[model samples]
Target: MPLAALLERVSLTFRRQSVPAHSGVVTFDLGPATGYPLKLHLSTWQSDEPFRWESEADSVTIASGAFLEPPGIAWELLLATEGEALLQGMPVSVRKVIASAPFLGVELAQVCGQLQAARDLASTSPLLLILLVDRASATGMPQADFAEWLTQKQAVLCAAVDLPASKATAKLLSRCTLRPMIRRELLELKRCLNTPQGTALLRHHAPLCLEHFIFLSHYEGTYWPGLLPVVDGILENQRSQPGQSVWLHRQLADIEGMLGDDRQALRRVMSLEAFQRLHDRLLDHFNDQINQVGRAKLASELRVQYGGYPPAPIPGHEDILPITSWEALLQEGQRMGHCVGSYHKSVAAGRVAIYHLRAPEAVTIAISPQADGWVLREAKARFNEMPTGDAMRRIGQWMDQLTDT
Candidate 1:
């Protein structure tokens, strides 16, 4: 269905009604008549005080704000549903004003002016009309255009919207450069935009590198958030010097291997040369293990010393065992044709923990500490192959147990 028709069916209504003396509130209602029932209530008193906002649906408060705060529940809900185009079409200037002046106080004039600017732009971009009406009605602001509205809003767009020119931005000259992005993608983009390297890449117009960066950023298997700059730097170098033997295509998997179970270790790595040195050392160590009997004896001794450090056995998986020693790592790596054996130092330092599943399939699992809890870094069968469906299901059940505990 057309976005306009969808919105009409949603039956969005906004009211700026007087409450008691010395106070006012803006209420937005999406009723069951439209199939999307939501109630947003905002209360404001004096100009110096912050406004409060809350969202309710089905007779329950889905979200609420503390004193003087404007909860993002309204915007988030809009973006999650059919109102995305309206929000995405809004100029950044208008968005900033709405966020800063939720109560329509000191910035009321500025807010109205931006809304008028939105009105002026709506002729050329019809979606802006929907956005303009939404904001203007919600805040009870006038929509007639002022002479300076268009020029001022244009200046804000040019200054703040420095994202690289792409097909997405090419058409949205007056709207947010990130207009095509959804909420989660916007969050990821914000993370990169805060960093100098990421900003540089975006502003410098490196589409190829940006494409690779986006791909790696969205990959859930690898902890790629903090390592975005590393990927950007490598891609930049590759672009500048194509003759270099950089593993451009396989960089993600290779970096994951180098990371082992301690993905955060990338932060301490000061330079590409330092990363190369660690990679070389791991390669050398993996190549040196040749004697199986010697490996077994060393595994026994190390297990005797560090066995208690491993996490308790996975409850129902009697065939699974935690790998607690360098010899065990080597054996797993040799059998799996992977570089996990080099993770002994990380395991010994308690930075990473490895688990081996011995039944249904010989799979090696690596879990590492993330922000608050453990995360599965990677799970692979022999020869660096992906585990079978049943094996993965079992691994997932074990991970769920870990979370429960």
Candidate 2:
């Protein structure tokens, strides 16, 4: 049968099972009526605890392998029936978030024009701007954009709800520590739509909601509800204190570190020298054990430059100094790119500046500080290939011969 035909068959079956319409409209279980077979998931999509009380419907239901609402349009899901063809129901969409840092300036731009036209600016409605970021990468482009906007015009920070490992965001507000009023709203999103988190929630009845406080919960999986609430609360508190972007940036750093994606954490800071220090430490971490052909050559080059093998960390110096792990180097290098600086002494030796590839994802290339230094590196004299400067030198030599004639 065609996919549409199969879905229609399922939809008709679901509508038939739905509670009948009332006088004008029947009192119905809207949850089942909206979609035939949506599996509820933890709001954050990654929680492993008991789900919120709201996920406990009369029974978990699935049709054609999907845990969905009855009478609602069917959706394609990556669901597998665990056993008995249809899967059992579980706990679902429950979450919370609190702004962790002072965030009053977040939405200033959106409200700026509105505030300008108002008779009493202070009396005008206070709108909140909530920002969320995926900690998967070191470059916090989303968070940084939000911070820049806030810096341009300060605004109130609304509730920052962390999404659980579940794939929920707007719905996770119920889990926010700062506001209980948003619970119904967050839950309603789950009930209305069979989100992936909702599917996970219904299939696996675990804690769908959680407080978004950094360092509050242990190092769990990537479900993010914990950090948002702290950010939300911080924003709420910062409303009274204008101009606190620096503090806000600092807080982001703290949360990024807590999640073990410290590369992102460090990028949130404005300092330039941190990466240089990071470079030194990363070299020490692997203790010169560069095994691969590519990495081994890079290591050999470093040995020639630094002049010795790196010693492993001692007990006394270990805690006092930052851990120079490869992970850290990769994270920082990915964010900043390798630190390129002048090799003044090396330039005098006919070499260009030293190009340090701090992250594993980079290649080191030497650039002489002198203008002609690049030509020498690109010349066939250095390599067998017809390098860029080789043709240029031939053209120049021809010009000289013509002038001599």
Candidate 3:
């Protein structure tokens, strides 16, 4: 109901103006707001002449089917102001282009541009997030040079697509280093895709998806066409592979044995072991079927699909961060609780530890550190449901380990 109510009205008109398409701003009654002069970064979809011209007509449809971000915003009006310059006769979805915001655009320039401004500069957010950039942009850094010479600490490099994005127009994606968009904002971005150009523009909004859902390195291979089946293949491979799921299963079994759930636990162990053998036998077949079909399915969508983990190694916990012992970790966590108590909470109240997963491919481990050793309470499975405390509880335990070691 809120969504329908929000899209109830959408119209655009054109007028002569010094600015280009911006002369055609659409205004909606999404209610009033505390106006903040957010200097937003935006891009547009160019339409053929008649549709563009009709867009400036006094009245047209702002269909509910179209998508917008900041969902209901009188703020969308700032992106456009109706003008008399009309091009063609078709509907245009005036989507707010999303980018690293607030501190993006001129705000960041001013701070980095001046020496005095740079001296007083600091960021307020925790876990300085980073901008996604091309491999070349990041590799340009010298081995010994610290990144602080570039931007704030909270700023991080968003992962890059292993493939070259554009024949030429790809730099925006390759060079983008920072943007702050929430789930709702992403929804808004997707909604705009219905217009002929909306889908193309929408992809520009979320290059991050290019990293996960895409392929890299080579083209021309056949592609897998379906999402669910690909998921099934990934699961099957995990079941069969000696690495990843296999390792986790072995670990889970030992814990189960400690807890006396031997039968079911043993069953899991055997199943994975069997799958691993089958996978090895069919390894050639699976790779052929999956890669050919998968690559084709994703080909047009992604510039280069990842083939056999490709050449570039991304920084993930290939190996866990080294710490001497769990006890040292706990002490460090307690110190964190003291320093940033408001942002963190200690679930270390007792012997019980619970790890709840927040998203796909991530796991939370719960533990309590002692003077020299530590205790494992509950380790949540990968990407289950994220209870509110799930992430923080897991991180706190991690912090405890860091401190203790």
Best by lDDT: 1
- CA deviation > 4 Å runs, candidate 1: 1-180, 201-205, 208-285, 288-316, 370-372
Give per-residue CA lDDT, model 3, range 200-273, as digits (tens): 33244433332112111111111222211322344455543334332333333323322232233223322444
lDDT preference between candidates 1 and 3, better one: 1
The sequence of per-residue lDDT tens digits that candidate 1 reaches over residues 325-405 is 566677777777667775655676666788898878989887878877777767778755668888988888888987899
Q: For candidate 2, what is the lDDT?
A: 0.28
- What's the true lDDT of residue 98 in model 3? 22
What is the C-alpha local distance difference test score of each model? Answer: 0.49, 0.28, 0.29
TM-scores of the candidates are 0.46, 0.17, 0.21
Candidate 3 wrongly placed segments (more than 4 Å): 1-394, 397-405
Worst 10 residues of 2 by lDDT: 78-87
What's the lDDT for residue 325 in model 3? 26
